[model samples]
Target chain A: MSDADFSLWVYLSRTPLLWLTVTLLAYVAADRLSAALGRHPLANPILIAVLLAAGMLAATGTPYRTYFEGAQFVHFLIGPATVALAVPLHRHRRTVWRAILPMGAALLAGSLAAMLSALLIARAFGMPETVLASLAPKSVTAGVAMGIAGSLGGDPALAAVLVILTGAIGAVTVTPLMNALRLRDYRARGFAAGLAAHGIGTARAFHVDFMAGTFAGIALALNALVSAVLAPVVLRALL
Target chain B: MRGLGGTILANLPRMIPGAALILLCQLAGEAIAHGTGWPLPGPVLGMMFLLLLLLGNDLLPEPLPTPSVTGAADGILANLSLLFIPAGVGIVGKLDVLAQYGLGLAVALVASTLIGLAVTALVFAGVARLVGRDGEAEDAA
Candidate 1:
């Protein structure tokens, strides 16, 4: 019995399953906590869940690889989820058509402005080159952001963190800022979310309405495409 | 119960391609990355390859699966909340990183989002105007 308990502890301490379970429970708790806090930007669930998980891992000294092993099942679903976005895009074909030009412009202007503004501001603050590289791809999706960051000599892992942070903050602030600006149209709202936040924004846009959600998906994919094509060319000019 | 079971059984074949296309892309992406020594992220490469395939070919496999009526596709998209679980969990592994760059990250997000929004609004507006009359013509036709 003692041997079994020892083995179980060993497994729990080293295996990814424990971390995965901890992540799930912490995520749920964070969601509840966010809701109870009236969904404040400061109480963002992703932010909280990440903090909670990180703390636990640090305390337990559990390697990230073990945790990732158990968590990858969830990661594998991302592809299907992305492909599934086509459904909403198909449904909102009219909106897409109407906004195609504006969307493209937005992506270009957005990407450039984002990269330039971040570097400018970071420079003003005397931030390091690493921070500049890390923040360059903050608005694009993780897949693209990591690539840009890596190519530019930034850390991919750091870039991933920056990307998520960008999305979470965007998700939190988009609605209120839009409302303040009196941007009532779902099309604009969704596009803004997708362009700015990537998938997280798309997910958040769905909460607003179907049109918004669909537009966000289109925006997300479009921005990714635009960024991929433009980042190298534009980034050369900036850096 | 019988109807539900029948419906599921009927749709299994159709659903396979959607899954297959994505998986195939992942595999091909991995292969291309290995072959070419491309520095692009594997999944990003996969997405690009799949996008090309989708655009270039009409010949998907035989007995073309009926495009989902609603359930399967809708079920996945609608559950995007859940879909983010893994990524979110992964984020948990990096909290110290988050804390270290919190404010700077926040500034970047806001700045980028605002720019993206302004640009999107402008581009979309211009496109809509150009396409607006054509859409009407199409409708009239």
Candidate 2:
């Protein structure tokens, strides 16, 4: 066989292609099982996907880069996807306008609280400054968080991981929290999920209701702005 | 012939701007980050910048000047999960970082999310009242 053929097998062996493929398939299977069990929030697709993928990587000894290479296609689209959120916000312009002042206040207060609380807790635990930077923007969407991390001198990779974990956890807890608080409005529930979790939580909210999705999209965008503004000033002081 | 040509011409101008708007925002966001030497990404700046533009231009009205923009946004968000594949793929390279830092990372994530939820809940509750929706009316609304 030619060097090319030899090289191909070598690359495949070193890479975690089989493990990731299995993980993705396992993720789909778990989702099917969860849906059959009646849409349990504990069985959330994001949560399942993450846990299963983590397990597979650990079991197979496949490196993360290899899986990422096979999976980066998903990452590339986050930018356009985020931009798309604008369409829904645009569609709800009237409602958005009617509640602009309230939404603005909520967005600002919620965002500041998210950042400050995360920073303080991480500090109390004696987490490194770099890790704190990554956590600083975790509440925002991944695309924005990654950018903010790079700008603020946080590890972008760590930020991306935090962003994913944040989304997954937020997606899982949103419904339970809403029910507990008696937040029945689809818009409020959705906005809260998306603002707290970003895209991952928004996806979960969308599965529950369209109004929730709309609110989540609005929350996602607004939080991105608030986090961007808050991360720098806050990090400067903390760092 | 005249109608066919006019149709394509009309769509061509509209479609180009819609596409360009997204690309421009992504690029501008990255550029601003680069220029300012801050941690902010270019696309984020693009988003905020777009919001400013929208506020100025009424760019987000229900009857957007063009349907293509809405369609474009829809197609992107619907399959947003697909975009994470690349980032997930990047995880392979960062396993070492993840391993060394996983616990701290997990703690930060859970903590921030709970904080985010509490803050959101409080803000909405407080704002609902301050705006005179009040607790009773808010529950009703």
Native interface contact recovery, all models:
0.40, 0.41
User: lDDT value for candidate 2?
Assistant: 0.69
Candidate 2 residue B80 C-alpha distance from true site, Å: 2.6
**Candidate 1 structure quality by residue, lDDT tens digits, B1-141:** 235446656886766766676666667766876688654445555655654554344355553333642345555565454445455545655567567766665665667666666555545444556656322212111
Candidate 1 - CAPRI tier?
A: acceptable
lDDT: worst 10-residue window of model 1 chain A: A83-92
Q: Estimate each model's TM-score.
A: 0.77, 0.77
Interface RMSD of 2: 4.0
DockQ of each: 0.32, 0.29
Residue A85: error of model 2 in Å?
0.7
- Give the C-alpha miss distance for residue A43 in model 1, angstroms: 5.7
* Residue A106 in candidate 1, Cα distance off native in Å: 1.6
**Model 1 stretches with alpha carbons more than 4 Å out:** A1-6, A25-45, B1-17, B25-72, B82-103, B122-141
lDDT of 2 by residue, B1-141 (tens): 235345555665556677678777778777777788765546656666655655566634462464666555655565454454345444555677678867766676677787777667657656765776533222111
lDDT scores in order? 0.65, 0.69
